[model samples]
Target: MKCLLVSDSHGSETELSEVIERHRGEVDAVFHCGDSELSNDSSILEGVHTVQGNVDKPGEFPEDTAETVKGVRVYVTHGHLYNIKMTHIPLSYRAEETQARMACFGHSHHPTAFEDQGILFVNPGSVMQPRTRPEQTYAIASFDESGGAEIRFYERESAEEVTDLYASFPAGTQ
Candidate 1:
C-alpha cells in the first residue's frame, strides 16, 4: 500500500488542494499532521485522516489517530502534544502503545524519515511554509506484504520526487 503524508500547510488551501489532487488515486490513503488552519468540514479535507495542531481550534479534530492500511498499522499526530521538537521518544512510545508500525507527524516543518526500534517515524514537512529546505515538501510511503517499506519526499508545487530525501527500510525492520 502507498500513502501520502503532509502537514503544516498553515492555511494555504490552494497548495493543500493541489497536493491532494496531484496524488489522488495514486495512494491508498492521505494523512494530514495538522496546522492546516482550515475548518474540519473543509472540502479539501474530505477523506483525509487529520489531527488537530496547536493552532487548530480545540475539539475540531482528534489529537491523534490510528488506522490500518493494507496491513500496515499507522499512527498519525501533529507532534506538538508529543514534544517532537525536543525528542521523538514520547511520540515513539505513543506509536508503540498503538501498535503502529509507522508514526506520521509534523510540527518543526523539517522533513525527515527514519526507523527507530522497528517503528518508522516520518514528518512530511510544511507544504506552504517550509523551514529547513527551500522546497515545500510532502512524503509518499510504500509498504509491502513482506514488511519492506520505503518513503520518498516530493516537492509539493512540482509533484517531483526529491531523490536525495528517500529512505528505505528492510523487511525485518518492521
Candidate 2:
C-alpha cells in the first residue's frame, strides 16, 4: 500500500489540491499532518485524514488520530503537543502505546524519516514553509507484501523525488 503524507500548507489550498489530485489514484490514502489553516468545510481537505496544528482553532479538528493502512498501524499528529522539534521520544512512546508501526507528524517544518527501536517516524516538512531544506516537500510511504517499507520525500509543486531524503525499513519490526 502507498500513502501520501503532507503538512504545513498553512492555507495554500491550490497547492494542497494539486498534490491530492496528482496522487489521486497512485496512493491509497492521504494524510495531512496539520497547520492547513483551512476550515473543516474547505474542499481541499475533502478526503484527507488531518490533525489540528497549534495554529488551527480548536473544536473542529482532532489533535491526533490513528489508522490502519495495509496492516500497518499509523499514528498521525501535528507534533506541537509532543515538542517534536527537540525530540521524538514522546511521540515514539505514544506510537508504541498505540501499537503503531509508523508515526507521521509536522511542526518544525523539517523533513525527516527515521526509525527508532522498531517504529518508523516521518515528518514530511512544510509545504508552504520549509526549514530543513529549501524545497517544499511531502512524503510517500510504500509498504510491500514482503514486510518492507520505503519512504520517499518529494518536492510539493514539482512532484520530484528528493532522492537524498529517503529511508527504508523491513516490516514486522514494529
Candidate 3:
C-alpha cells in the first residue's frame, strides 16, 4: 500500500492542494500532520486526515489519529505534545502502544525517515517554513504486507524527488 505524508504546511493552501492533487490517484491514503491553519471545513482538507497542531485552534482537529490502511497500521500526530524537538522516544512509545507499524509526524520542520524496532517513523518536514533544508518537502511511503518498505521525500513546489533523503527498510514483519 502507498501513503502520502505531509506536515506543517502552515496555511499554504495552494501548495497543500497541489501536493494532494499530484498524488490523488497514486496513493491509498493521505495524512496531514497538522499546523495547516486552514478551517476544519476548508475544501482543501476535504479528504485529509489531520491532527491539531500547537498553532491550530483547539478542538478543530484531533490531537492524533490512527488507521489501518491496506493492512499497515498508521499513527499520525503533529508532535508538539511529545516534545519531538528533544527526542523521538516519547512519540515512539505512543506508536508502539498503539501497535502501529508506521508513525508519521512533524513539528521541527526537519525531514527524517527511519525504522526503529518494527515501526517506521517519518517526518515530512514543513511545507511552508522549512528549517534545516531550503526546500519545503513531503513524503511518499510504500509498504507491503511482507514488511518491505520505502520512503521518499519530494519538494513541495516542484514535486521533484529529494534524491538525497530516502530510506528503504528490509522486510521483517511490519
Q: Please provide, for model 1 over 142-167, each residue's C-alpha lDDT reduced to its tens digit, 9 standing for 90 to 100.
A: 99889999999999988899988999
Q: C-alpha displacement of 35 in model 1, angstroms?
A: 0.6
Model 1 lDDT, residue 33, Cα: 97
| Model 1 regions more than 4 Å off | none
Scored against the true structure, residue 161 in model 3 reaches a CA lDDT of 95
Which is superior by TM-score, 2 or 3? 3
- Give the C-alpha miss distance for residue 18 in model 1, angstroms: 0.7
lDDT of each: 0.94, 0.91, 0.93
Query: Model 1: clashing residue pairs?
Result: none
Q: What is the lDDT of residue 16 in candidate 1?
A: 98
Top-scoring candidate (lDDT): 1
Q: Give the per-residue lDDT of model 3 (tens digit) for 1-174.
A: 999999998889899999999997999999999999988999988888999999998899999999999999999999999999999999999999999999999999999998887899999998889999999999999987787999999999888999999999979744
Clashes of each: 0, 1, 0
Which model, 1 or 3, shows the larger lDDT?
A: 1
Question: In model 1, how large is the Cα lDDT of residue 57?
Answer: 86
